[model samples]
Target: MALVAAAVTYLLVPLVRVFALRIGAAPEIRERDVHTVRTPRLGGLAMYAGMLAGLFVASRLEHIGAKLADPRVGDGQTVIALALAGGVIVLTGFLDDWWGMDALIKLGGQIAAAGLLVAFNVTLLWIPLPNGGTVSLDSTLRTIITILVVVVSINAVNFVDGLDGLAAGIVCIAALATFAWTIALTENLEQGRLSVTAAITAILIGMCLGFLPHNFHPAKIFMGDTGAMLIGLLLATSVVTVTGTVNYDIAHREINRFPVVLPILLPLAVMVLPLADLIMAVVRRTSYGKSPFAPDRGHLHHRLLQIGHSHRRTVLIMYAWTFLFAATVVGLSVGGVPLIVFPLVVLFALVVLMMMGLPLWRSGRGGRGSGGSHSARRGPAPGSGPTTEDPSVPGAAASPHAPATTG
Candidate 1:
């Protein structure tokens, strides 16, 4: 399913790019932007196409498609609702990317889309209790919680989409982790099955991987709000589908030592990085008497650039952190503290340390002539290229501003 979705998404991107150009969806270079070019946005249109293709293919497969045909299971309906909600978000994003909308209006649109999900019975019904029990939510409470989850997840991904491939890569890692956990549960628990959650996640991963080539450092195009918001909606839907509907009692029985808190912790663990960034951005902006929605260069990725990591390295570093965080949490849930897990944890920590220290180490060996001092002094600027002290290093470099190009 992932492979099929990837192929479809990859093939559709060129077409989407052309459409974006025709529709004037290119974004002007901004001070906070790392890309020096006015790249076409609305890449989410291709992602949406790929998602449809993936789901269509899944609907025909015997094993996976069974859930779609089974009237007793709500997975089929959930998939439809997810697609509908996703379409709403993509439209909102497309509009914002093409002509821009006020932040409050965008928020209202997001909430409306979230409400659609609740109306489709995609909201949480019950939560697992730590003492081998379950607590159910009343209709009113469920609606509020569902909307909040959808909104938060949407904004979290949106907030982290500051660099090329950042949001896509992080979400891909998260989706991959989630699929693994879901598959494990399906296998171990008798009541568990391959449902909309697993299918949606697989498609999500494919969409990101397919779009990543164009979105990587020195990007040829951007996903803009369209792609970012779409990805967020899909991710939030998958999390809700799995966390809200999973048989926690069966999960507890199968993995006795698994934390009873896994229902809540699992989603948070998968999304820890973006959530952290989102929370910090809000706090930081509010502290300075600025709107939380106001854009800035103080994002985690921006800080990585500040620390002298090149564009590619900064992206890779973020990927590393995301993988480490997701894997550790998933590992803990699936297997409680296995021997090999500790060594793997140490290795990841060491890798992070090495990446963080690489610039300093190279600078020390090559001296100030290495270009490190120059890049460091260049500081953060919008539309500025990455600063690499070493000329040999391939990083974003400040370039002369070209005349703004329109699609």
Candidate 2:
């Protein structure tokens, strides 16, 4: 299913690019943008098509078909809800990509789509207790929580899309981790099987992977709001399906202590990077007496570039941190707080610290020589020099013709 989805997305992207061009869906270079050139951005259409193809394939498989056929469990209904909700976001995003919409209007669309999911019974109705049972949420509370998760997730991904390939790569890492964890649960927990969560995550991974080739640094195209919000909705839906619907009794029997909270913790851990960025953005904006929806270059990735890390290096650093967090959570869940996890964490921290300091170290070393190192003498490599302009603030640099920052 993943391969099929990848192939479909890969084949469709060029076609989508042309369609975006014809429809005037190309985005102007913005202050918050990393790319200098205007790029077509309805690439989410390809991703959505890939997802549909994957679902179609899954529905025809023997084992997966059996699960879909079981109406009592409502897996089929959840899949339909996900598709419908995804369509809403994709349409909303496409509109915004072509002709920017008001922030409040976008928020309204997100709420309506989230409400649609709740209507289809795709909601977090219950949560696992650290003790030996579960706590059920009242319908109103469930609806509220579900809507919050969906909206927050959509915005989280949207906020992180400041750089080429950043949002898609981060979400792909998240979906891969979630897919692995979901597969583990199916194996260990009673009444668990190949689930909608796993299927959707697999498809999500494929879509991101397929899209990355065109969307990476020095990108030929951008996913824009369309792809980011669509994937966010899918991710939130997967979290709700797994965390809210799973029977925790089996988890209680198979594991003890902290592992019992894995269901709740897993989603947060997978998404910790973006969620943390989102929280910090809100607090920072509010503290400055600005609207929370106001755009700025204070994002973690932006800061990384400002601190002398090259664009590719900054993206890699974010990827490393995300992997460390997701892997640690999964390791703890599967291994039950083993001592080795600490050493692994320490090792990762050292690696990150070293990465963060590398440019400074090299600069200091090169300064010792009058002529500078060979690479320095040859001029900074592509995307290795400091950017004079702040990409998030229009006309921040002295020169109007300065090159745009790339990441």
Candidate 3:
């Protein structure tokens, strides 16, 4: 299924690019943009198409096909729900990429998409308390929590989509981790069936793998809002699918030995990077008395760029941080590492911090002027392109002088 999605997305991109250009969907360079050319967006459409093809193929498979179609065991409606919900996200992203959208309107679309999932019975059915107790949620509360999860997830991916390949790669890593965590959890529970959650994450990972080549630095195309939000929906669904199946009695055991709520923690850990960026972006803008969705170059990626990393290097650094953090948490969740591994992780973290700060250390007196966080005041680094705001569709408060740009 993953391979099918990859090949389809890979082949469909050029055609999507042409169609975007014909429709004038290619956004012009903006004040906060990283790319120089008017690159066509709506790559999410291709991804969506590829995903559909994958799902269709998956439904015909002998292994997962049985699981998906078994009404009593697995809710086949989830597959339909994912498809319909993805359509909503793609359409919303398409409009934003074409002419931008009002932040509120875009948010409504996200809620609507999430509502589709909840209607299909994809929801958080229970919560595990720390004291080995569990609380089952009524439909109303579950629906609200599920929607919040979907919205927060969509915006988190949107927040991290500041650089080429950043969102796709991060989410791919996340989906991959969820896949591993799901399999481990399922095995531990002795549920021999190929779980819906595992399958969903597999599809997501494949779609991202297919999209990454086009989105990488010096990228040929950008995934834009459509792609970011669609993948976010899928990633969240991967988490929500298994939230109910975790036996609290089993999971709650040895809470001190390993994380008891790994099903929840794994996704949160995977999202820590993007979510952190999202929170900071909101706080930063609100503190300035601007809309929380206002576009700015204060994202974690933007800071990496500001610190004198090349566009490519900045992207690589972000990727490294994401892998380190997610893998560390996953290792803890799975629970077979040597005690020395923790110390090694710390050593790795210190090395990462050193790398993160290396340019500042190397530049000494001269580097001070160009390091990031001061890009707005100092301008771009020597010979570097002018810095720009993110202008993401979720909440890009455009300059009064320029048309709204949700590229």
Which is the leading candidate under lDDT?
3
In model 3, which residue pairs have backbone atoms overlapping below 3 Å? 32-388, 32-389, 306-372
RMSD of 3: 5.0
lDDT of 1 by residue, 352-388 (tens): 7457756665555322355443334454333232222
- Every candidate's lDDT: 0.69, 0.69, 0.71
Number of backbone clashes in candidate 3: 3
Residue 367 of model 1, lDDT score: 29
**RMSD of each candidate relative to the true structure:** 6.2, 5.8, 5.0
- Candidate 2 residue 335 C-alpha distance from true site, Å: 0.8
Any residue pairs clashing in model 1, and if so which?
31-382, 371-389, 372-389, 386-396
lDDT of 3 by residue, 1-407 (tens): 88988889989988998898899877666655433576677788889988898888887888777666655322557678888999998899889877778888888899999999888778888766545466788989989999998888888887777677888998988988778877776666566343677778888888899998987866677787889889989988877777644555665553332344556766776677777667776787777777775666666665555555666777787778778877786777677443345446555754774578575547742233433233333433221222344434222222211112222
Give the TM-score (vs. native) of candidate 3. 0.85
CA deviation > 4 Å runs, candidate 3: 30-34, 70-75, 247-260, 336-355, 358-362, 365-407
> Residue 41 deviation, candidate 2, in Å?
1.1
lDDT of 3: 0.71
C-alpha TM-score for every candidate = 0.83, 0.83, 0.85
- Estimate the overall C-alpha local distance difference test score of candidate 2: 0.69
